[model samples]
Target: MSAEEKKTRQMPKGGRKGGTIFPRIALQDAVGYARRLVSKTHTSRQPRDVIYSGVVGAKAGIGDVRISALKQYGFLDGDAKSGYTADELAKKIVAAPPEELPHLYGQAVLKPTVFKRLFDTFQSDTVTRAKLKQRAADLKVHPDETDTCVELYVASLATAGLVSVDGDRITHLASADMSETAAISVVTDENNQSLSNNSTVNSPATRIDAGSDTEAAASDIGEEDKNGFPVPPGNSAQPAPRANFNVNVTLDSSMDIEKLQKQLELLKRFGAI
Candidate 1:
């Protein structure tokens, strides 16, 4: 391949880079796929077509995002050409009792360097969806996928019960064993500051809940944050003309239709003016 052609070649999704590309699907999604495999194939490697036919979604197809997620979580093994089978961790999860799932899933989640880093960095600190996005920006995540990355990461965290969301205030919960680390107690002070591992952290100032998921996620991660997903520049003609305006709105957890309508109306009024 010529130098220019090599530069044009796409980067491999995960195995090669740590956190450059996060899991497209959530933990529960990967769990669901593995659960189906346990019921149908019992950990045996089966042909790609067979697995695809047996475990199909409402969309009539299982996507690469899901397959990649399963692999990242150490839930699935083998390749499309070599066939696919549920890995040992997957077998254990399927066999474990109800209460053990969160613990097991927590371990699987941290396998990805990105998730692991986030968990390590934010496990002790108060985290908002916006805060996570900011951290992602710090990690050089692409602007276009800022919301998507946070959404999927939040989904995984929610599934593992790692963080509890309440009206934009996220209280980090003690999850599975990180092996090298010892267990600790969770205590909340009068001000809702989390005290854990003998350390104290005041509640975050931005108590914005993670309920709306993507509302505050469109934060800028810089123009160069093209982590394999690039956000192309808009055409010159597409820029707003008359109502040249920049507005910052704080959308609360009460994202009811009425509230949404009001915000929409406000923006529409600007356009009309």
Candidate 2:
């Protein structure tokens, strides 16, 4: 080869692979390693290669075929993405499966910064009682209902090693030096109390006037005349006999008490009581 051509060939391709070199394993083998790490029996961490070999061995066995294919299928579901780094794969093979990973990323590899941010948010923003209250309000749930949702979110974050709880306080996985605002924003302004109140006010239950029947019954009873006493007939034995008074007060006072009681009972049964 010419000197110029040889010099050009000597130059490394793709700028020397950019960062640290990571060993690659077959998709099936990677899955098996992950499963073994997650299995209850395997407590110690195993290398990625060792896990892959185990997966291959398991696949060859009749009963183990289903398990062997699990990791492979899971990766294929995400379009052949292993979703884990070499070190992470090794750790997973020794520790647990991606499915059992407590965080949102599961067994998938994440940048250290990203993982740190996620954990920080989980700790400061997620665990605080105030933050939880805000979240519940934003979700339109009563404060009483916040515990369950917060617990679930915390559990998920724990799996990912993003946050840890100590009594009431949550310790983030990331360094304390990280920005607190990012974490604070997560639980802020999530309260839906206003929306909930509006919904309640607009609901059919509250909108209905329950005492309407009572008001209507009261109105049905005719109003008394302007005088302090009830108007009397001009021919009746009264001191003040108004010549223009023609309405009979005796007929008005003859209301059926029994009928009124029966109507009230019916209204009570109909939830208008």
Candidate 3:
């Protein structure tokens, strides 16, 4: 045989000598395989090599293949070092903004619970109870039930688009407009009640009558006390007039007038007016 023919015959079918051998798989392909395994199992505790071999075998319909490609490519750590927990990894994946996620975990569907964890991380830092109580007092509202009051305030923040709920965390998303809206609502409600109370106090029906002799004597004593003068014997100063303006405003403005009137009627019927 010619030397060229002899050399050609000695070469393997696909270019190598002896038995046919394939080139090592690319790192990207190995990573893809590993990712697929993790996603399928939904657990990270499995033996990394076993999972990789199973995935590759399942896909290629071949005999046991070496997972050395995964190790060489840095897809598998292969050491006993403690890495971040699955929950922590899931949290990181979820917290990643929609635009930035494609660069991190590649293309994969994230579960809702994972997203919730991300949200919780964002919302973990929130307004404290003391701060909320101070805010309530500043707004002239009695925060009798501090716990419920804070919860209601947080709900209000959510409704006003100033905050969002990410799992158990209360994430603040307040903009200048949102703050202004909340502040304006609180101030307006307080001012409206103050004006209503003033109107009620100045109403003619609430004026004290001084026509009777007993009423005149009481007024005389009250005037003496107001003028910083001493009162004579057997003459007691009148008690200061206490005007109680119990103003209850309806929170639901979306309700029709007829519905509101019916609610008022119901309250009156129940002697709650």
RMSD of each: 30.9, 20.7, 27.5
Q: Tens-digit lDDT track for model 1 on 138-223?
A: 77677677788877777788787777777776666543443322232122122234345325233453345533545543332113
TM-score of each: 0.54, 0.23, 0.20
**Is 1 or 2 the stronger prediction by lDDT?**
1
State candidate 3's TM-score: 0.20
Which candidate order results from sorting by TM-score in descending order?
A: 1, 2, 3
Give the RMSD in angstroms, all C-alphas superposed, for model 2. 20.7
- Candidate 3 structure quality by residue, lDDT tens digits, 88-174: 333344455543433333212111222222223334356455655555444434445434444544543353344566555566642
Those runs of model 2 whose alpha carbons end farther than 4 Å from true positions after fitting are 1-130, 136-145, 175-273
After TM-score superposition, the amount by which residue 151's alpha carbon in candidate 3 deviates from its true location, in angstroms, is: 60
Tens-digit lDDT track of model 2 for 1-273: 788988777654562322211113323344444455455224444443443354334323432333333332232111113322223443444554443333223333232222223344454453564565454445444345445435544554454455667676665554443234334433332434455657776677776655587785554333434532232224536443223423222324677877666655544433344
In angstroms, give how far residue 217 of model 2 lies from its true place. 99
Model 1 — which ten-residue stretch has the worst lDDT?
182-191
